[model samples]
Target: MNYIWDLIIKSERAGIAKRDISFAVAEVYSPYMELSLESLNARTAERRVELNPYYRFDHIFDGMFDINNDEDVELREQLFDILIHFLADIDLTQGLNKREFYIRFALRDLENGAYGDKVMRSIGLFGREERDMIALNLLRLYETGEAVYLLKDTMRKVFKRSTIYANCEEKDELLVYVGQEETEEARAKVGLIMDIFLPVRFHVEFYWNRHFGILGLEDTMRQDGIAMY
Candidate 1:
């Protein structure tokens, strides 16, 4: 994750434009977005909730946490604290949306320099195969439509183990907490998803503040003698 962040920041020095950085990040992290949508569908099915309700996955688009990063409310608060450090570390103009941000950053590294090269090499992620695998799974779930109906069907089959809906308003919040806290298995599932998104969250503030040219980062970098690099 540090490697990804380093590549993003170094892209500026290597002559990678902010636009490209945004594009790359979006492309690479696209799977997380798909996961968010699929997870939302799963929750709905579990609760016997109606399809295409007012609170679609898009409604919970509260940054990557809605997908990968944060956990419950407390964890989300903690993540914001971490975000502060990242904001203080980068430079830029106006931050792009999440999708745009990832693509541009990844492309920046690919086209200009190799700031992330060693790490990717170490991980054996030479091309887009790994990226595509993640992205494709999400797409497959989305297109199959089975993922959307999975929870409901499962619940009907195993009624005792299924969760009941309390209120639609707190649906997303409830789903996250209950799924993670109700059973050890669920907790592991949540943690696994969290691990998937942790890298993105670690670098989120770096993208936002730097891409948007937040004034404080320049001052912080200068104070710490980090601006020279």
Candidate 2:
């Protein structure tokens, strides 16, 4: 996501140190670094086949040793794109958690300056109940080792749907499919979740089929520009 990177660049320009940005970026991409080269090759190849039949992973990984290396602009850009797509395609809750980690890293480095305050407000800092919920859920996750399941369950209840789908898009926004039910109600539920539960800084969108399997099935209802809670 260029927007995420742009935020880092903007923060640096706003007086945050380059090392801090690098550290945050490193943390964001650390999950990729842990994967084996063979695993990366296979996964990237599979993704390329689905996305671009003509794209070759070999060209991107041929001489690439470090993705963070800046000497070869082409390699770096390609690798960054791969990582971005990889992150986008993963589980929604996991992706948002990683994003939250990145935001926290930036905030820690920025501290209490004007830029930091702006970022803080943009991310919607947690209040007492939200903070307590986070702590309680973390403990539950540690004890049961089902953190994703817990989040998915909470989401299911909030949307009033037994089966709902969630995905993180390329723009780092969360998209939730709430079926063909009451769209306004779904929006309100999402607003509440964003306000009380979401720990990360990113936008969310609710998608529904307005026509409900009718002639206008191709047309989808989308609600965006949701205010941060």
Candidate 3:
């Protein structure tokens, strides 16, 4: 919980501001793959009752997260509940709906990491088996922190911004142009342009809090797993 506060403050300072604080909070609390399978299984049980007040099989069949999309009523219910629990437990603010929040944030994370294609392949919320497998693999990467870093690196490459200064008369207006050259050298040393590595400072500071916070998450790292330096 202390880590939660630190993240809030860090994000607040990093241009996140108060408007999207709940979203940031939800992102920080989201569980990775290292969490026990039993936790997810337990959530499934609880979700069944909450989602299906009537407890009817046919009506809620389409809502289940299944590979086959078959009417396996029992398994479907369990899957739906587990997914719901996984989503709800992340953040429980009054205005936020669990399912909607998860889907939206997941999309943002994917976009930030340039993993949109991988996420699409996983079909996580869309109920596809291949996509589910990819999601599981990606979760493993997240547990190791490699996935997060991988996404960060991709983001640095994708939305890399630059500033250019041109010598002009006092009355001359500024002009901006997009680069058309597809060469590495051109991309690297953009003429009259000052290149700066823009770090997503919020993520870095939030991770610092995550590393030092007393969540036992850092301690769970083995030599084979992720380690904070």
Candidate No. with top lDDT: 2
lDDT of 2 at 128: 30
lDDT of candidate model 3 versus the reference:
0.33
CA RMSD, predictions in order: 29.2, 20.2, 20.0
Per-candidate clashes, comma-separated: 25, 0, 2
lDDT of 1 by residue, 1-229 (tens): 1222333445544445333432111222333332112243332111111111112234433464434554576665445434432432442324656654555555444334343443333222212333333333333444574432333333223223333222235333212112112444443333332233232312111111112222665643444333211
Between prediction 2 and prediction 3, the one with superior TM-score is 2
RMSD of 2: 20.2
Tens-digit lDDT track for model 2 on 13-71? 34443233321122232232322222333311111111211123335444444556669
Per-prediction TM-score to the true structure, in the order listed: 0.16, 0.25, 0.17
* Poorest stretch of ten by lDDT in candidate 3: 190-199
lDDT per model, in order? 0.32, 0.40, 0.33
lDDT of 2: 0.40
Model 2 TM-score, 2 decimals: 0.25
Model 3 alpha-carbon drift over 4 Å, by segment:
1-163, 181-229
* Residue 156 miss distance in model 3 (angstroms): 10
